[model samples]
Target: MLRTDYKPQSIRQSGQLLQRHSSRGFRWAFTGTIIGILLVILSFNSGSLADSHASQLSTEKNKISAEPAQQQLSADKAKASIKKLPRMNIELPPDTDGRLSQDQTDIADEYENAFPRRALPLSIETSLYDESADDENPNTLTAVTVQAGDSLARIFQKQSIPARDLQNIMSLGKPVKALTKMMPGTVIEFVRDRQNTLIQIRYPLDETDTLIIDKKASGYHSKIDQVKVETELVSVNGVINDSLFLSGKAAGLSDNLIMQLAGIFGWDIDFVLDIRKGDRFTVVYEKRYAAGEFLGNGAIVAAEFVNQGKSFRAVQFVDDKGNRNYFTPEGYSMRKAFLRAPLNFLYVSSGFKRKRFHPILKRVKAHRGIDYRAPKGTPVYAAGDGKVIRSGYNKYNGNYVFIKHGEKYVTKYLHFSRRKVRTGQRVKQGQTIGYVGMTGLAEAPHLHYEFLVNGVHRNPRTVKLPQARPIDKKHRTLFTASTRSLIARLDLEDRIYLAQLDRINRQQAALSNSEISPKSAPQ
Candidate 1:
């Protein structure tokens, strides 16, 4: 053997030398060979034991069949403290003679045991560096109802929420002020975390609007969430048997709708004195809905009233400026120049007479105005678009209001319990000026209504007043377009209602015939 000085080989050289060996260097390599085999066997045994131990410890931890290469590398870096899961060098034996197992079940089993699988997260966000997550997760949702004498500060204090938070939220602006002005029975929603810090708030402005305030990392944020309301046209028809209110109720109409119906036809017909038996009306109105939930009726789209064999039709028209008013099909305004009576009357307590015995004075005098008996505090309207020329009290007419409608017309309202307007204030027709009351020279709560033409007292009920302004020329086109479809639908609905009424009458007639006998054949 040639003399050769021993030089230690590196790990790379040793790995290459293991693949091919020579007999001259067998002694020095024998110990290294035995130690490498022992290490390989110890690694497999430790892996098996570590696998069982990890499974025992992390029974509740999420498990995955295949570990990602990145995590496996991480596991390798931490192998000193953790269990070693390195791949082995042993060659897997064939299952059959010169034939490898196609299924490789044995190899798969060894591979599964060879590495320590990490408990993979079941979540998709597996990033190790996402530190901006919210610490306060609002979980508890509370809806605090506003009661009488409750302020926003008190509400927040009651909820155990910091008043500072409420102040911070209110700093967001006008939309947030809606919360501070919550009415009785309104709801204010709050979202808080486990630590009881308020994260969000919602204040409903109306049926179709809500103000939302949210807590962000920077500061409190707010936005208005306006809910879209659906408008559905609904038609209701009824015959006046006893009263319009009774008939409307039976026809499934709300008091608001019933009042609206009376108002629409009030210019043409006197609802108090003109609504009689055989009177029928058909109304197409707007029914509002928010998120499929009923909100309320909006406006009367079209209405038809047959009073005393005379049919009065009116359709609501909205112009481009969003101003809405009722008008006839010919574009004449349905609102007259003046209301027949300044206040709603229950009955005619006294008529205008030249020589009428005064109840309080016990003397005969010329009663200048018609006395309309109504409930005390009932509103008194202006009756015409005018200015308040005089508003004062007197011995004869207490709390009197005299309005000058142009130079030719004047209207007066007397015996007011409460005056709502001041003198020299320009007032519109139907504007409330005062409330009905029994004042000087009055025996009961009634409105003494008078209409004067050129300073001469005239009958408010039978006088021919000036006409209301017609629809503007620019709005005529839009009004015609909007009302055209509504008018057609109104007519169709009216016809359908008439047919239904006729069918009902026929059914009743047949029932009457069935109920009646032929007088026993005149026996």
Candidate 2:
């Protein structure tokens, strides 16, 4: 500055230096301003982020501190509730292997020891008798009387013997056949071993007796011996009210026995039509027993049926020829040539008459046959076995059938709605001939029945009937034995009924005495 020299080259150089310095300073200033603005914006944003982070950390600390207190309160409540409950005791059942407990094992042992045991006792007398006897053992024999209806198998079962023993004993054909047919009231002896096993079974064959061995393996055998027994006679009485079947049951009679009684008196009495109220029957027969046990009832050896004040008695007798026949006391055959009626309950709507007023014609006419009143379409049967002679319709008889029985018997059925048989046809007894109807000159449904002997008309209701064939001579002896046993059973039944009646009477008498005593007491 002191030397102020003014030169063109120096001036130009100075201005250039001033311009370069100013340019450099302006560039530095602009760069510094931009960096400061960036720093300020970054500082403001970083401060906001730090504040938010601190607030989040404080909330997390508060949550961590409060969680433990809530959990402790929940745990305390749970413990208090747990303390308020009651305790329990439980019992379990014992195991199946019997190792559960001492008490259980002891109870099981006691149950096993409680059952009873039995031992077989040998008889000393049997041994003594066997040693003293020669080839035969002498011992007391017990006999069992065979009751009526007792079968071999049944008796063995009742005595508690194994049925296999019966089969072994029956292997001997002759002994089994003889014993199987034994009649009720017969005596059978059974010999048993010490073990209660049957040793021998003995029964009668005919006049000769037989025995059977019980043990097949030992080849044991039976001995035959003869013994006699006695039986008693008994009577049974019955009265009829509703039907013959019921009356027989009321009197302790079986259906088969009642039917036999009905058949015995079927000839003289028409059970279908002639049976009346208060008809009483009494049968006297034998009662048979083996060892005081009841057997089955036998035949009606003698019977009486009192009907309508008339008494009919029949006695079964075996003649010299060994033929059995039912006859009256005076030896009259209890049989007739024709039965009174085929049906048991038919009614006589019209009777046999010479002159009778006809219902259809309204005039007196000859009515030769008996008209039986029955339901419409009631079956009309052939009274006996015969051949049909005529079966057709006629003017007076709408439908008719005429049957000829042998040479002396002829029967006619008229006024039928329809015919069942044809002419020249064979018919059996009780075969349906036609049906009842109001046909021809009849006023109602009925069967006009007629019986003729050699073409002469007779009364059908009072006609005699034929008898059934008697038992053969060959079976007579067996029949008598069997019948006697059955009769004995019937007798026992009668005694039982009498005993029941006595008991009833005693009860009634006691009741009557009690009632009278109460009335006579001073009140």
Top TM-score prediction, candidate number: 1
The 10-residue segment of model 1 with minimum total lDDT is 60-69
lDDT of 1 by residue, 68-142 (tens): 545543444455524433444444476565554655666656556544455432334458644436445337899
Error of 2 at 280 (Å): 1.9
The sequence of per-residue lDDT tens digits that candidate 2 reaches over residues 356-440 is 9998888998888888888888877777788999999888988988899999999888888888999999998767878888788
lDDT of 2: 0.71
lDDT of each: 0.82, 0.71
Displacement of residue 474 (Cα, Å) in model 2 is 3.5
TM-score of 1: 0.69
Q: Which stretches of candidate 1 lie over 4 Å from their true place?
A: 1-139, 160-181, 193-199, 214-223, 497-523
Local error of candidate 1 at residue 431 (angstroms): 2.8
Best by lDDT, which number?
1
